[model samples]
Target: MSMDLWEYQQDEVMSEYYQELCLSEFQERAIDEFTAERLSSYYVENSNLLVDSFRALEEAQKVSSLSPTSGLIMAAISIEIALKIGLLKPIVFGFVHSEAVAESISNAVVKQTGIDRFKTLLVTLLKEISHVDIVTYKRSGTKLSLWDERGEVQKRRNMISHKGSLSSSQDCQFAIDVAEAILNELLPDVLTSLNLHLQNKVIVE
Candidate 1:
């Protein structure tokens, strides 16, 4: 809890599953009344899911040592969520400017009822809309984007889920790092478009 919020009471529930909220510094930063009025629900939903992806990153790190496979799977899930909701959905909505069209496209991309694969959709959207060619989007000072970024971890997650493949702490850490990097790299654009500031124990930007 960054703000040490004083609660009047407590819920008779498990704190382990509770998620912390980002208390916006609206007092310090002046609110844009006009923009606030025109804000889209797509933006709000995407922002919340992006925050969830980050939260999953932290949870994966926390469990990396105890259960490597679980950690790896969690990190992989975070990557996929960040990819769709964090980057693709917002960018699509930004261009289309119609929530209905955007929602339909987003659902199709995410659901993928054997029409197009999830990974295929992700690459196509990144290349066509965002102009981010992930294949050529190399890591800084290295030609390591081939597997270190997203694909390898996703494959590993599939293996673990379908084939019960065991994983190591190193694998878990790598997945966690990749998930965090992808989310962090794409986060600024989403936040800026939404005209929102983010802060918490895990995220301070």
Candidate 2:
């Protein structure tokens, strides 16, 4: 289905669920306000952090050959900052989506079904955010197995952080490259997911 059609359908489903579940008006309003305030604050804080990390990474790339240990340290710091910011963007977006779903569901129930079912809608919205896989960590030999690419990225990131030993210019450059790749591939995807969740008002269930 077209994205717009899919979103309309989701809103319809949420409306039905809300009416069927029967939530209170007060509870529904509270969830809406709370979600908005929290999401706004989270976005402000995280976006700034993301920008700062991006600037640092750019500066690092221009530097002449760095000592192995320095390169690894800098790369590790940059990656950590980038990943944390990336993860936060989606989570905040998911939270906003949940809130919107709750609001839409509440409105639909009151308007169409004449039911007071806001509590269940709010609970379900929270549960959806709770379950979303906004970020995943891939350690070696873990239950949620890392694919080859992710595994390689993780290894390189780790080497930069833990290897500490002197690395050649090539090794340092490689670490920087890995960090750059992760930032490029993961950040945009995270932002897009957040925007989709917000625009569509989708819940996990």
Candidate 3:
């Protein structure tokens, strides 16, 4: 029932998630190429915000008569934050090598485009920079593409953000699940691939 408890739980979840990802052998490689300082500086704050909003949702769910609007909003923001993190990580990794790419990512960050636009930008950026088509990339070490749309999480988030609608606890929980999947699986994979590509470029040049 407390945000502090929720925060603690969130931290635990992320810590476990990161630990698993590290076992995949991506942690050292990604950090070596991407630079831990840059990634942490660009990501840590928004990542914490994501956890905060998720905690807010959890706290609200404990109240039976409370409006679900706030929870829905938090869920939506969590999705957006995950997407932004996905998009910005590559730029942070590559910025020092390519100012033009960095400038482009900076512009996208300044505009803070919608979720769909952000996805498009992310997909395009990955392909342009690394020839990796993210739309086709599997998530969570599974064979399913990240954009399979089976969960309808983005639709729910859009309804809340753009139309001022609210979702039930079930849907809100589903959205949080989707957020966790993206944060733990999709973003790391994309960044790992990007870092590999950047490292190869460095070697080839």
Candidate 4:
């Protein structure tokens, strides 16, 4: 088949790379290993969900007084996103060779679980991945369990999203508290385990 200029250049690059790999001792791995090694770095670099979550939290805070309902929704969304990307993805990726498989399983686990089972799933994920005792995690200056706060805030968020119910400033603050607690308490450990660092609002190793 005739190749375009870009295709010809690509083939030449691949050929040179293949020849270099053939001579290298590290090239003896299986194709899946090669794929994983090449793709895993890309996944980690792009998959820091906390970056967006922080942005959401900031927005939630700004709108808390002006629009409590919006604040509550954004806060809840941030927590949900952080739970999946910050906690779930890197944890599950460690157990799989391919990022593709880890991604599919993560999506399915989050999607298939209903609201009733959400707490159980969260408990299991935190326990297995972070070894965190969810029951003992309390919000700042309050005796409220972080897990229960997460549940209540999220339930309110669901009511707002599904039934178009308006939220009070207190509810917005409640959701924000949950977001802040999770971000402060859980994020550091999670980031450390993944060898990730937050710098100037960017997440990196």
- Among residues 3 or more apart in sequence or in different chains, the pairs in candidate 3 whose N, CA or C atoms overlap within 3 Å are none
Task: Output the lDDT of residue 129, model 3.
Answer: 49
Off by over 4 Å in 3: 1-68, 92-110, 118-121, 124-133, 137-145, 148-151, 161-164, 191-205
What residue runs in model 4 are displaced by over 4 Å at the alpha carbon?
A: 1-44, 113-131, 193-195
Compute each candidate's TM-score over C-alphas.
Answer: 0.62, 0.42, 0.48, 0.67
Between candidates 1 and 3, name the one with more favorable TM-score: 1
For residues 20-134, write the lDDT of model 3, one tens digit per residue.
4323434334434444334434443333423543444354444413655555556555556555544544344343335465444343342344545335444545564456576
User: Which of candidates 1 and 4 is the stronger one according to lDDT?
Assistant: 4
* Top lDDT hit: 4
Instruction: TM-score for candidate 2, please give it.
Output: 0.42
Arrange candidates, best TM-score first: 4, 1, 3, 2
* 98-170 per-residue lDDT for model 1 (tens digits): 5675455444444432222234434544444345556566555656772345778877887898898999989
Worst 10 residues of 2 by lDDT: 196-205
What does the lDDT read for residue 163 in candidate 2? 69
**Candidate 1, position 59, lDDT:** 85
Kindly list the per-residue Cα lDDT of model 4 for residues 1-205, writing each as its tens digit. 8999999787666545433432242223322233323233644567555788888899999999999999999999888777766654444444445567655544444443233333443454445444676767776687877777878887898798789999999989989988987876676654554455566545666
> What does each candidate score in C-alpha RMSD?
13.0, 17.1, 14.3, 11.7
- lDDT-superior candidate, 2 or 4: 4
